[model samples]
Target: MNQQFEHDDDIEPASKSQLKRESEELQALGEKLIPLDRKQLESLNLPDKLFEALLEAKRLKAHGAIARHKQFIGKLMRQVDPAPIHALLDKLAGVSDTHNAWLHGLERQRDRLLNDPKALEALIGEHPDLDVQQLRQLIRNAQKEKASLGTPKPLPMKAYRELFKLLKQFNPEPPIPGVLRSDDDDFDADE
Candidate 1:
């Protein structure tokens, strides 16, 4: 007569202790895929701007901020070699984010304004030169420049450039500022 024994499939499931050990092994394997050190990333010798983009992406990732992470990832793809990080970014892009609201500062501001109609109207009334689209643009500009709404004046071009870079990450085909009709032809002003 054959002796009864536990079949492999019928074996008792792994305990939490055993499962934790397995998870640690898997995590080690995952760690081998990418270097976690900031210096190693810097050594990639990516273009200065692209490097900045990557660092920004990393910052967002570290903070669990998905939107900025995606924005910088997309910008990296467009502005730099799309080979190394595309696969990783593609996987992330497919995973929908519930907390992407803070990714774009302008978006956050717009939401606040839109939700409060009085605020929206007040902003519109104050900036009469601003159309709806311009209003959106200014918000973005303000965010990028780190200027507050209560600021006495619009931000400088350098500040705008910071925000523009952020915007271009999401919208690769953004509009270019036109040449201003000014008397000083020698001056290359950004407006």
Candidate 2:
């Protein structure tokens, strides 16, 4: 008994039910990754085998094949750190407070760009990587669209949306607002 206890001390063993729940959660995460565009998938920096698996999953249309592929992807996920993946997915889904704030900021900035000519200069200064010419064209088009809105035959609101999308692509990630999650109240074993 003493020898057996010595082998498993200092760590709480997980129950079978707990393990199953974790597996299901990971499988769900993998399923979410399947629908992501190539750019988003590449940003995850997944391992080559896992990346190929995801691409293959995307191509699969049969229900049974997709289900089995998700299980395989879940197996692959077990080998990778899921924290960053979770963070990126949450940000993309706009579920987190910071991501939602970032989107609102983009909307405000788009308004600023429309109302103030100098806003474009300031934004370009902040994000040097932006395609300045395309941005300028989009801004010009949005401005024209807004100006024509009151006219009898106004152009449809295409550029306005395009401007917002462009701004979103170039905007920086939002800063955390220090709101703690309710789950933070969970007991910490380290303590």
Candidate 3:
């Protein structure tokens, strides 16, 4: 019994450095919450006092005031469960592997459209809701920009960016719970 007790005592508690690291993480999470719109912030279900403190922090323009408020928010965070908050933030920030893969798929489609003229027809066929004329014009502009670039000069990506925005707007919605997505889905094959 004595030897067992001594063995248990040999294990050290978390170090001050570890505790400081945890505190800093909490502060960083609090700072992220500050930039979120009021509706999104409320969705996190933060403690009432912490939410008010965050709103106050958002209103503070002075550096010292903002710093102090941030510290207060961090302190309040210690009193609440942070796991759910972290999950919500991760979802909102598109930090999940699945969300990142979806974004990458969008990039691939954009690249395909830029490189292949037939891709425009295929995309239009897939998404009939998209304005065919507008897409054609954008593709023409993007191809022209790509061809006109001088040696060592980068192509202006304005049309490319616009095409991405349009694709996202018309991208098929991910199937909800209990409804499995079919492989035949037009956009986001990984979904």
| Each model's lDDT | 0.43, 0.76, 0.73
Model number with the top lDDT: 2
Ranking by lDDT: 2, 3, 1
**Model 3 C-alpha lDDT per residue in residues 1-191, reported as the tens digit of each score:** 89999999999999999999999888888888888667666656667999898888889999988898898898888877777666555555667565566678888887899888788889888888888889888888877777768757777878877877778677744432222343332323232
Q: Give the TM-score of candidate 2.
A: 0.61
lDDT per residue as tens, model 1, 58-153: 444554565545544444444444333333322224321221322345444444653565755776676565456754565555554554445777
Sorted on TM-score, best first, the list reads 2, 3, 1
- Look at candidate 3 and give me any clashing residue pairs: none
* Tens digit per residue, CA lDDT, model 2, 45-139: 78899999999997899999988999999988888778767776776565666667766888899989988989989988888888989888888
> What TM-score do all the candidates reach, one by one?
0.22, 0.61, 0.59
Candidate 2 Cα errors over 4 Å, as ranges: 1-10, 59-65, 116-144, 147-152, 162-191
| Candidate 3, poorest ten consecutive residues by summed lDDT | 182-191
Question: Over all chains combined, what TM-score does candidate 1 have?
Answer: 0.22
What range of 10 consecutive residues in model 1 has the weakest lDDT sum?
173-182
Off by over 4 Å in 3: 1-24, 35-45, 60-68, 79-100, 151-156, 172-191
TM for candidate 3 is 0.59
Q: Model 2 lDDT vs. the true structure?
A: 0.76
